[model samples]
Target: SRAINADTGVNKQLTQMILKWRRPGQELLVGKPEYKSVIEASLGIPCRHDELVMEVMWGMKRFMPSLVRREKSELPKEDLLPVSQGLQMLLSSYGFDVKPEMVNDQIVATASVLFDCDAAEKKQYRDFHALGRHLKNVSGIEYENWDLLKLATAFKIITSFLQ
Candidate 1:
């Protein structure tokens, strides 16, 4: 089985190289080898495009981190906003007239309201806040209490909007 696997792997590599050269100007990048192997192994034959895309999405979700921290100026896209933008877009989708800049303030007030509410309200709010805490670490933000509260509120607002 090991010798067969080795032979088949070499054959697939040669086939991939031939296909790469004969097909178009497109070239495979770094991680394609693992992906190609997965596809070939699954079918006991060569890899295909459908398998590649499916595998890439699954692999990215499995291995890649949720949020990547980078300087706004260093980002490839100029129009990208901070995490607050996600909240605004969610609200926008629900036809709310909320601006992205205003989300921060809204969240602060909402969190304050949550804190002052009854026990059940406090629990619910805390649950949402916990989710925000998880995301804060993932986002790699230097968030204060207020910022975290705002993030939690933003998450609630967006989730509600989506629903």
Candidate 2:
């Protein structure tokens, strides 16, 4: 996948607005008429609902996470290494390239900044998030709330058949 230019100016502003105004279970769609009207008025152009959905999806794909590096704690590296490595491989395979390290029992990248890639790479992260949401919907287990060990364990269980 090739790099996509960052959203700037009006597009960036519109993206932020769309994200801020979005509601749960309506991730891609603009459910409220008032929000739609506001978006159209902000752009000073006539836009359809589907077009707004596309814009929201586009913004989601380019959404970047703020990686705040944690100081190394007394947690055992032996316990953290395998989980970190597993996550690193899993994320790298999807083009996110998060070289996650264990910090205070959580898996975070050693680098303070994780998103140095373009929209294509960033989209992979969005896909991963969607996968998590789907898993929650199906199994009633919130993957987003899982810790590093739990995430790695679930990842291993889910991907074991591929091995």
Candidate 3:
């Protein structure tokens, strides 16, 4: 709150944004337009929209190395075809360094950090208010719509992997 001056906050926020763990190769999937722009700025170079995706990806790797350091072999098996196919396609398409076996581990760990089961209902999904509370309690950031969107993505991924 105190330090996030409007000036440097964009860069600082972008830096913090990309530092989190993404499932195996997702850190490289700049499917969103915003990712490329921030990454390009971080690299201090422009990236091509089509051909140079890998180069920008490399820039991201150099910018944040700790993201892919952890790997786990045992993962929960929901084995839903769409989920399995989706992950497999993503892995094959992106050539993510994360091995297939470790993907679920990364997904679950990332989920643990990003989403919270409702404190009252426990099994029910948290509403936006609960999400805001949980996120604030977890990360101390005032949870915004963007954070809610991030949590939704994590929830969908985690739910797909759960039995």
Candidate 4:
């Protein structure tokens, strides 16, 4: 079957409008509906015109990582962390919002959250400001007098009961 453009020619003005709006970063758009809205606003193009074009553009972009090349290397570890493991664990709960690797140096330089490595080796947990901060960060729940082990034990018991 012949395309509609064969019957009624393509809108040159709309084409030009789309060309103007379609800068480099706009190609790999995250949301299709939002992209459609932008296209509709920029060009007077109807919703139905040439879904094939969108399909091909999106398909090419989906494969772009394969097309592009990069060099990978192992990152050095930060054992002497300025930030506490408790805080990193807390922030990691919001992994979408907080990238631990990206801000790790800043966390380390801040010199917050000291841990007792000796106690960890001995399998002993203690009450500290960091654990309270972790509970607050992870669940937005603040307990005035709760140790890390107590919190873990409580959570374990509760989860078992609920299950």
Residue 120, candidate 4: Cα error in Å is: 59
Misplaced by over 4 Å in model 1 are 1-116, 142-144, 147-149, 156-163
| TM-scores, one per candidate | 0.21, 0.23, 0.18, 0.19
Query: In model 4, which runs have C-alpha deviations exceeding 4 angstroms?
Result: 1-17, 20-31, 47-61, 68-163
lDDT (tens digit, per residue) of candidate 2 on 41-152 = 5544343466445445433322222222343333345433433333355456557644334332232332213334544455755666676787788788878766445655
lDDT of 1 by residue, 1-163 (tens): 2322433444456556555565344433323456556435643345445544544543343224333433223321212222243344445554667643444435534543544564566676677667766757777654346543576667777579779
In model 3, state the lDDT of residue 7: 35
lDDT of 3 by residue, 61-85 (tens): 3324345556433222432111333
lDDT of 1: 0.48
lDDT tens readout by residue for model 4, 1-163: 1211333433567466556776654542322454455445554444432445544443344334445545233233542222334455545543524444455545433323223443463354444455556758877876657666666775666569778
lDDT of model 2 at position 158: 81
lDDT of 1 at 86: 37
All candidates in order of TM-score, best leading: 2, 1, 4, 3
Which candidate has the top score in TM-score?
2
Q: Which has the better lDDT: candidate 1, or candidate 3?
A: 1
* lDDT value, residue 139 of candidate 2: 85
Q: Estimate every model's Cα lDDT from 0 to 1.
A: 0.48, 0.48, 0.47, 0.47
